[model samples]
Target chain A: MKSAFTRNRPLATAVTALVGLPLLLAGCGASSGSAGSENVTEISVMDYYNNEPDKSFIGDALNSCAAEAGVTLKRETVPGKSLISKVLQQSSSKTLPDVLMLDNPDLQQIAATGALAPLSDFKVSTEDFAPGVLSAGTYKDKVYGLAPTVNTIALFYNKDILAKAGVTPPATWDELEAAAAKLTEGDQYGLAFNANPTYEGTWQFLPLMWSNGGDEKNINTPETTQALQLWTDLVKDGSVSSSALNWTQADVNDQFLAGKAAMMVNGPWQIPALSKQPSLQYGVVKIPVREAGQTAVAPLGGEVWTVPQTGNKARQAKAAEIVSCLNSDKNQMSMAKARNTIPSKTSLAETFAKENPKLATFTELVKTARARTGQLGDGWPAQATKIYTAIQAALTGSASPGDALKQAQGQ
Target chain B: MSLAADLSPSKAQSRQHGPAVDQAPLVPRRRNRHRKERLFQWLFLVPAVVYMALFFGYPVVKNVIMSFQDYTTATFFTGEAPWVGVQNYVTVLSSSLFSTSLLNTALFTIGSILGQFVIGLALAIFFQRKFPLNGILRSLLLLPWLLPLIVSSAVWRWILDKDSGALNRFLGDLNIIETGVPWLTSTSLALIAVVGVNIWIGIPFNLTILYGGLQEIPDELYEAGSLDGATGWKAFRYITWPMLKPVVSVVLVLGVVYTLKVLDIILGLTNGGPANSTQTIATQSYALSFQEFKFGEGAALGNVLVIISLVFAVLYLRASRRAVDE
Candidate 1:
């Protein structure tokens, strides 16, 4: 019995090795089977429009585009946050979809991986697109993606509350501070914005930071410090809720809708949800600048469509056609109108703004909007992290604005 | 024991056969029988061994290998992760945030375990009494565990909201303070609040296990102790405490392991915010890999966490062995 027990131990280990080897081989085998084929009748697409309105709108556009290109569409939609990881996983497995939709900021990071095939390779035209949109899609002077429409953050305020408080939408820093303070009352803060520790927080802070002459390249500068100080002062003086530190953009919208916040810094995407409540009389304006003449340079917010390097030339050509079709002037206008975003083409902007008057502020902001990844390329995430860290530290009163910037910069 | 019983009968039959046959031939026949028995034993263990290797062993090995390389987003496409020796480990360990994450991890784990175990034990003991709806109450206590972690975190987020949360509203109704408490927003209070929520989620697991242990301790000992003038605290000290040690060790060790790598609760609650006061090693590792795309440093930090868990596992093994010996 003792001999049998001892002998069985090694046999168990051998069996484990035997089973694991086959499983590994099987994984490799399955991935290899997905390699390029000659005849391509179906074009696979992946995106992050998993929610309503945008989902149906984007899905309809994709289906129409696929029909235009004379191919069947196999589209997969994931949650917003999981899109990048899913793309990376699919890239490594050599199973990346023919067309992949990436958030504008993430396009550069993924393109740097050599996983995306540049649109230039297929001679896709990007003429008449907004400069900011083009810059967002360009990495290393090569355009890898194109967005149909884009959006930017703006100050959204409740008309009823602001009228009762006798305050106009603030256009400059001092007016903003004064209006916020005067509007503060029981159970209602004057302003709400996201300052959580994530990329969303960084995106929200960018308008204030950039409008004040701060640059992502060096956030420790005095301009950035001043921007940080404004956020700190807003929280310190009780004009903004201390809970803004934990609220997401969605939560900020909820606070605005529930009348807990009189004003919010958000984007046009909230228009659908805001319109659902016909009782809500809201208006949008540019996020305020430090001085009146300075432009409120908010970061451009949107997703870009790109063809991944799936090693199938025929499918990639078809995918590029579909992507180009999705960005056509007609589709862009309709998508922007339906989705409440500004069309990516400069020519379409005036018409879009005229049609959707509520998005005029956003369309105006998009003209001077900056792409988060445009400056840093693939190195943007680290700097974005530092910005939000400094925001958190300064707002939480753990460090002064200047000191927080310096500390985060050092990190 | 069952294996021994089967082997003994076979050995006896082999001995009976050996006398009727030639001794030289019987030796080979017995050896053949022994080989068949060993093969059968190995076959019984194959499924479990294969499952472990495929699921547990492969990922661990892959992670360890990844920690030594300069893995990044580019590596996923190009499939080239150049060797960087221990550079990833050095960078992660030397970062200022690493120390903070480590300390927060220690505090989060310790606070969560202590609160869960103590409260869980108390509840388990209380339920040991005869009562109407005892079973129903015990099962109801498991609601937190049954609910998804993200759902619970979201509910807790609203409940602990500074301005409009249920908790602050209650506190305000009682006139405890003028302002709403920032349960999840303040740097000073975030970690504590996270630990409190974790403890609530963890109680059901500890209670179920400890309650099972409590049941296994025969009532005869308690009755005899009572007859000897031991009751209440004395009866528990003498009769219940010693009997519960093994189960207590198991629960504590398991609790520490689970709590050490907790990610979803913290991510949903705070996302390691308010100056990263609530950032733990698990969350930091996740941020490094997924958020920043620094897979090498993430893998290194993950390995560090695995080592910490392994230390506890070894200690538990030693303690359990010693308990068995006694």
Candidate 2:
């Protein structure tokens, strides 16, 4: 050989480079593995449920049920800050957990994504589940998710702060704004809220939009603009701090518990957390209306259990079993007790109320509470992003509610 | 160090531009000798090449093809693509948000590059010579760069929080400021805050690279220049500046490419928010893909991102050559 060294040098280098590159890459890359259905007897249920340290909670009860049912359960509990993003990411990979818990309106979005597996395998209907709870998961005439636990918005007031300030809970936005101004003082913000578009901006503003006599689907209407304008006025009048947009729902609950703010628009989920706080002297009521013609609105919020249609019969069957367990009356009651949610079991409202007194007003509000305009389980993300972002933008002076909604809807 | 090489390549591809088929054989024993050499070369390269072709190259081509088809994951692996050619591209190009992302990316890149270069160069020159705790200081300068951008941006998010944040906390404590500024909540201030974070992150890399270049300049040159009536700023403008040109070009080109593709920082910091003020193309692409449930549109966004970065690379390379010519 005229020289093996000279002849193979370039070849060896190239080969080494080729082999080394793959080895290096293999050692350090995110693998998009095929989601195998083999041995998938168990279903993973992820919830936007916040974990409590208590010995008994909704998450723990669910785990106990899974243990009782002899099925594997992957329980994921996430904070409000990362919940939506985590759900979205999991959905994109077709690795959606078999069960999910979150606001009902989001289930509508997931259904629209074709991510929430249809409940066809289980063949459950709206009649099989609680009214309004099942509506968020029905798309194209197919039901997708089942709500095991549900909670909707309610106006929360610090009884101690308001009582001390000699103010009554306001029934209308104008009175609420007035109460806020009266209560606000040195280093004490009057009202606490979360104005995040995907979070409070959607949940809190939905009621405002409804109070102003605007429909969720028609979010860019003049009434919606006026509703947003009212909120903007609150910000300008110094009744509500502009910083609320960045506050998380959990964060607002903390501020309320700390007695930092006089009143806040919150939901039933805060009941268990707040009830234990020694400084928490709060009462729940209907979300305030802005006009006499309008009624207070509480945006529909809840969770759903689902089965993804990945075309694997065995996998689908296992997922369905998980969903069935989730929808069972026993599980629903368990979830309600642990999650501190409004029982989706219509029959248990009285029981839930007697056990948790803070939930009583929210229950009353639910009678008139506005279900999100995603009856077909569609159009909320597109609409809410427009409605809520506009409301926030107007409040922050990024746009007039009129212009913000107009811009958001691309009108 | 954490950022060094943590990406899993189990499916990563190794790419190569092979010699043409008409290449002359090695002298005489080039045939059998070549066979053995080729065997060894192929043996080593086979794994990486196969990995790349399977994972990266194949997926890229597949994704591009998928972009043209009206398809989802369900449709793609089913052995056929319903080719509705150019529909995805049409949807993206027609969308107004695409244009916004492009404009935002441009603004973000240009603004950050200027800040990184000027400030990085300053720090680099400042740290050029030996000093007390020189090694310690150089290592400490790498802290922001060394930490994951996720951790950095998360920390920055706390600092920029409108309430109970470090920035507002410090400012209020000094009594120099009366009210807490909404560093991120404001539409006008959101982008600026994210850019400020990006600049903070980008400075260390530039400083490290430029400092490395600064060290290469012999100390005698500066001493000789000082003797030749070149002192202080004058010495740097003459001997130091001309010599550092190659390294500066490298930093600019490298920095531009990397910053233009930045996704995590912008996402973690603002999410293109306060109404899309901080929205970059990558985050927008991510939003389109996951949030909006439009994978084709998302892929189109990635394509646009790739095209934009390619253009930046070409332009920077041209500028680098021009500098060399000058």
TM-score of each: 0.94, 0.83
DockQ by candidate, in order:
0.48, 0.21
Residue-pair clashes, model 1: 0
What fraction of the true interface does each of the listed models get right, in terms of native contacts kept? 0.80, 0.17
> Tens-digit lDDT track for model 1 on B76-112?
9999999999999999999999999999999999999
Highest lDDT against the true fold, candidate: 1
lDDT, model 2, position B108: 86
- Mark the regions of model 2 whose C-alpha exceeds 4 Å error after superposition: A1-103, A106-128, A257-259, A271-276, A310-321, A367-373, B1-30, B39-45, B54-56, B66-94, B98-100, B172-175, B315-326
Q: Superposing all C-alpha atoms, what RMSD in Å does each candidate have to the true structure? A: 4.1, 6.2
* Tens-digit lDDT string for candidate 2 (A1-411): 434454456566666767677687676554534366566646576765564552246556666657655677777778855766676656554555666665566565655555556777566544644556656666676777777667788778888888888999988878888899998986567888777655456777778777777876666688888778877887787777666766668878877777677888787667767878866667877777876667666666766666654545555666666666666777776676666676666776777678867678766565555557454244555566666667666877877888888887783
